[model samples]
Target: MTNHFPLTAKRSLELLGLIAIFGVLYIAKDIIMPVLMAFFISIMLLPIYRFLRKKKVPESLSIILPIILVALFIALIVWFFSNQIGILVKDFPQIKSNVSQHINNLSDWISRITHYNDKEQKAFIQGKSDDLMNMGTKLAGGAALTLSGVFVFIGLLPIYIYLMLFYKDILLRFIFMWFKTDHHPKVKDAIYETESIIKSYLIGLLIQITYMTILLGGILMIIGIKHALLIGVIFAILNLIPYVGALIGNIIGVLLTLTSSQELWPVITVLGVIALVQFLDNNILMPRIVGSKVKINALFAILGVFIGGSVAGVSGMFLALPIIAVLKIIFDRTEMFKQWGVLLGDERPAKSPMGFASFRKKKPVAVKSGTEKEE
Candidate 1:
């Protein structure tokens, strides 16, 4: 009476479907990445677009206005960083001198430890010069790819965003049509929750970047660190990537401090400042601002970042968490996929995980690298 073949076939199809999805993502990343980025930007701008529509603004104006606002905000950030970079350029000679001194000191220390005299060191480097040249050539090609990718992203982004905004109603109708009439309520809820999660996560990230820049930069300024603002801004932006981003930020901060200053105290101070700031961010700010709406566990979050990076580089990493969150939302709302949602989410209550909506926010969960109150 029990026919196991049907069940096995169903599972096989599901596994194949997942593989095909990933294969497509990898193969068509050039187009997929830009469209995905545009989608997120559109979702983030949805509230502003809706508000303008309510005021009886023209359809085109409502969309154009929000995009312009986003452009202006980005331009402001670019302008500020340009000035900071100019300041650093003016102090370049001093920075170069300090960097050279540190490099010589490091070389000497390495030579002493490894028992490689100056002549041996020179020979070792000379022997590797050919390999280094080949590596440099490869890097140059990669750089070309990167530059072209940037232009493609800039060109396609506005177009994709406009289309997404213009066809928003059509997309909604398609979503509705994909489900039965009886599931309309669930589909609507999934859409609403997805929008809310994307909005909250993005807005929270902006807040996090702002305050991190202030606190981290301000502390470094007080400590007389050169390029304090530069280091702070770089770290703050990179910190948006989650988990591994902080580590990268830390290394960059330390590297900048070492190159800019002769004294070691500034390096120590920079590390300490970063640690304290990260603590404040992880424990205090994220929970209130982002909440726990997405609820993705740490393992998948970090894996998604790395996988996205491997697939599409920086943009992929930036888009990873939010994309995963949106997928989780859809999965959670469907009966056949709810178990996958549970695996994606944190191990918490079956009824409902405590979030900002719960009124009584639960204590932050301890993760391997740091604690995150928000998903």
Candidate 2:
């Protein structure tokens, strides 16, 4: 006799529904990116809003303060860049000459070490010189495009931030409304945990970046490195990318240092300083700050960074940990997703003890001199 287990129409429809949902998300990618960005930014700023509210400040005032501060900060950065442009423009010729001289010294050193003749060395350097020039031009163009995009986005940002800050409660209520009324408590708990995780991650990230910037800048300055401020700022920003970021920063710093001076010791000293700072960051600062909040394993954290970077670039990488934390939070609260919670969570929930009979049956202890022991 043959037996058949037929697929029901309901099961077919359920599979179709899942596909449709994913299709919709794929189509809405552009819209989702901006909303996600605004949401994370709001999450990061929520603590300040809560603090103000706790101090008896009006919601409007609390919201307005952070928005204004953000605007002022952007304006300050713009002003600084505008002022620097003039000096940079005036010194461009001298800067180019200095750079060219450094490049020549570096090429000569490489040629001597590699046994490349003058013609071969010059040919190699010329090709690199062209590549460098093209890269600089491309960088400049990209920066211009980014600046333009920022200006366009700036107009929409205030409104977006305000709505997020003001109607946060209503928005949250709408999300919770999807679940059954009895599940509301669990939903709220999940939301709260997720918010706490995002907030903690952002605060920790800010502290880490600021500390890294200061430490890096001071070290570079002490070593009398030119463009120390620029290099430090670059390194600090790159540090946001997680594990590989510091290494990239160091490589860039060393290359730039090599270009600036023929002295090997200066480059070695710079590397040493960066290594020390990285050691401190990884061992002391990261553990105290980010590690607790982002309880994911190193493998998952790295995977998260790569996936985020692939999807949203640098912004995504920076947002990845909090995103994973939020997922873990939700998983922990939802009964159906408890298994996922176990997978994502760093801390394993302790197992309850089995009944004495069951435990003894499984163990099959040996008795010796009135003492029982498991073999």
Candidate 3:
């Protein structure tokens, strides 16, 4: 007779294991995040690396050249933003006047709704402003620490990417070594699929960012919104966060519009333009460019964003979808984790007998041996 494991005990162990994994992620996120980012970047650069190799470029130069190009592209973006920000600073007086006008308008609206006099409104706002000031002071110190960490993250990223690219064969060998010879083909397939997914996803994102920035910035500039390009840049970058990102981008766009302009029409126009652009992007651009290779469900995507944010803040949120996609790839290919892949996936299942009667499809009636039967 064979001894069987109890189902409840197995499930409890699984839950505990999951909790522990999350704990480890939260603890080592600072180190883990950069490495993970580098891994993705290296994968994205594989085509370039291989192309250079085919051209007889030296091994070290192949890796170094891609890194250099990527660095320069990033530097150009930084320079653009810095220049725009400098210009924005020069218009501070106008922005300040607009802000004061908006505040007074808000005060009047609040007075009408709540029957609060100007003095009471001013006092209430003053108290809130004091609290905000205190919070800002705390955030300033935190920002300095965050800024230092960012520098370190940037410094280590290229080194990590270079090493990963350099040791690509060793990594492949190690992965192969983990599995039996018979399973080597499947492992190879999974690796290839994973690389394809990462390459398509990241490259598609780059394309999306460029177009989104141009479309949003150009439209906003046409509408006479101040600092149009800056808003576009912020939105395009933030929009990488899936469903939540687009919403946040819209909020930021509106806030920027409100701060820059004295008129309410620009804010409304910003919203309308963003909505139209988002509609086009979601309905048309995403399907064509990104494809349905990683069809993550809305529920899981939102949950992943929130969970990632809790675990490692903005970086985690940004990395969450691709990580899930990679995990789904592995899970779908592995016997033990296929159920998890199904759970994470966006595939809709056929209605079951256990489902609501209204949702279940009617069975066709058939005659078998002169007897009516449901088929």
Which one is best on lDDT?
A: 3
Q: Which pairs of residues collide in model 3? A: none
Query: Candidate 2: how many backbone clashes?
Result: 0
Residue 251 of model 3: what lDDT? 91
How many clashes (backbone N, Cα, C below 3 Å) per candidate? Answer: 0, 0, 0
Best by TM-score: 3
lDDT of each residue in 1-375, candidate 2, tens digit only: 123223355446756874785466456644555667678778888888989999999999999898888789779767855764565577667666667777677677887788777788778778998999999998998898878766655766777888999998899889988999999888877777788878777778778878887898788898798556656766777888878687789887886676556566777888888889888988898788866766776777788788777766666677677777787777667665454555565542222224335322223232233233333
For residues 50-79, what per-residue lDDT tens digits would candidate 3 score against the true structure? Answer: 999999999999999999998998899989
Ordering by TM-score: 3, 1, 2
How accurate locally, in lDDT, is each candidate?
0.86, 0.73, 0.88
Better of 2 and 3 by TM-score: 3
lDDT of 1 by residue, 10-54 (tens): 778878998898899999999899999999999999989999999
Is candidate 1 or 3 superior in lDDT?
3
Give the lowest summed-lDDT range of ten residues in model 3: 361-370
Deviation (Å) of 49 in candidate 3: 0.2
lDDT of 1: 0.86
lDDT (C-alpha) at residue 373 in model 2? 38
Which ten-residue region of model 1 has the weakest summed lDDT? 359-368
Tell me each candidate's TM-score.
0.88, 0.77, 0.92
The CA lDDT at 174 in model 2 is 93
Q: After superposition on all CA atoms, what RMSD does each candidate show versus the true structure?
A: 5.9, 7.4, 5.9
